[model samples]
Target: MRSVEKVGKTVNDAVTEALIELGASTEEVDIEIITKGSKGLLGFGARDAKVRVTLKAPAEVEPQIEVISEVKEDVKVANANKETETVAPPKSSKVKNKEKKDSEDAVVVTRDELAHVQALAEEFLYKLLREMNIEATVKSEVVNNNRLSIGFEGKSMGVVIGKRGETLDAIQYIVNIVANKGRTEYVKIMLDTENYRARREETLKKLAYKLSKKAQQSKKPIILEPMNPYDRRIIHSALQDSKIVKTHSEGKEPFRRVVITPNYQNKSYR
Candidate 1:
């Protein structure tokens, strides 16, 4: 883990300074406020707040596939050292195995199509970022079944994420269109800059819980400010199973928002 110490007018200011230096979100760091500086006599004797922030270390990658070559070498040595002849499997069983292999190859993502989508996604995103005058390295990975994840690594996350990921969503929409155009099966594309989506989802989840509590206390509908469809979905999913409140989306696209209201059906019946 890497750590830093900063001084600012307030604790929040000091923490923000550390986060920028670390290029991390609030959830990714451990913060310690060494001193909560106070104002003393009209900014003359006022002391600046001091803080220590530590970032979590990245996870190590798992073991990998270079073992295949060693296995091949062992097989070659075994065949060379064998003194007895080996018998082949029956023709019928070989046919069955061939059929099984063909079936396995016919999954939702074909090898060729996966490669094509990965290339297209990376190129499209790189070009788009260049057009926006942002220097970013976009890498593509094939994930799950026929899904392409385009990950961005750069310092412009705040701009790319926008006020609430509106810009990111807009960019993903266009990238999806470019990737799936004229393709037979849709290859789902997810664009993220350094776990931004995961962090945003968590933030929205907490917001849902807080707003639900407010709605429960007041017994009044709480209309959240406007959000994009992606954010609205997060709110709805977060409160879908809440016992105290119900959630719904209202208004139209781009301006749509989530409404959280207290559940009153059982209360009314009682």
Candidate 2:
């Protein structure tokens, strides 16, 4: 594999410099952080971050060719044998038409159906808030004709948001269930307050980057705190393009956590 080392003010900068030198995308290389540079007090002991980027070996295409050759050889042998065998007859036109119709019958939400789901979600959310004695106005919007985004507004929204938006997530889950009951096409429901969901997503993305850097620097796996599937997805997506670290989740729901590990093979680095 071809490799190059570069230095910059930060890890991202160093990785970018190395990528430019190697003319490779993130998916085509494995990156190792040699040093996570620091900004010392008063710029007296400042240091630059250093990274080594190695281009990954090209994938072998010979195995696929071999498999195809084996299949062809089997076919040739079968033809040579010329043994009498029972063959199943082709399906009737009615059977084929029925199969096609079954496939085409897949449920799709129309504009009216989307509006119905939106109203149902909004109504359920409002009633739930009232029962909790949290005075908040529910606003709903349709997204992509199959998703509903519900927003809560009012001074008492902090209660609705709850700790880390757990309460909001639970409410959204229930609202989706209620809205999709007796419906063939499922509609997704998203609930948020004070832009909490968006803000939390941003925070998770930043944390993903920081932990990725730490994983590369320490050359070890970093297990993050437990997060819901939604938050876990945010972390995964944030580092999906990174060549230095890879992210995955483990454990069951409600306790599942994101794990960040350095993406490198068992090889010595210069």
TM-score leader? 2
lDDT of each structure?
0.69, 0.68
TM-scores for all predictions: 0.57, 0.58
**lDDT of candidate 2 over 1-270, digit per residue (tens):** 889998866776677556545544454578899999999999889998998989887662112324334533543554466521111122343465567566544446799998888888888877888899888888888775556777889887877876557678788889989999999778877888899988878776766776677567656566555556777778776776676766656555545555665666524212
lDDT tens digits, residue span 213-264, model 1:
8567655566565555666677776666566776655555544555565677
Q: What TM-score does model 1 achieve against the real structure?
A: 0.57
Please give the RMSD to the true structure for each candidate, in Å: 23.5, 17.2
Off by over 4 Å in 1: 1-107, 266-270
lDDT of 2 at 100: 59
Off by over 4 Å in 2: 1-107, 265-270
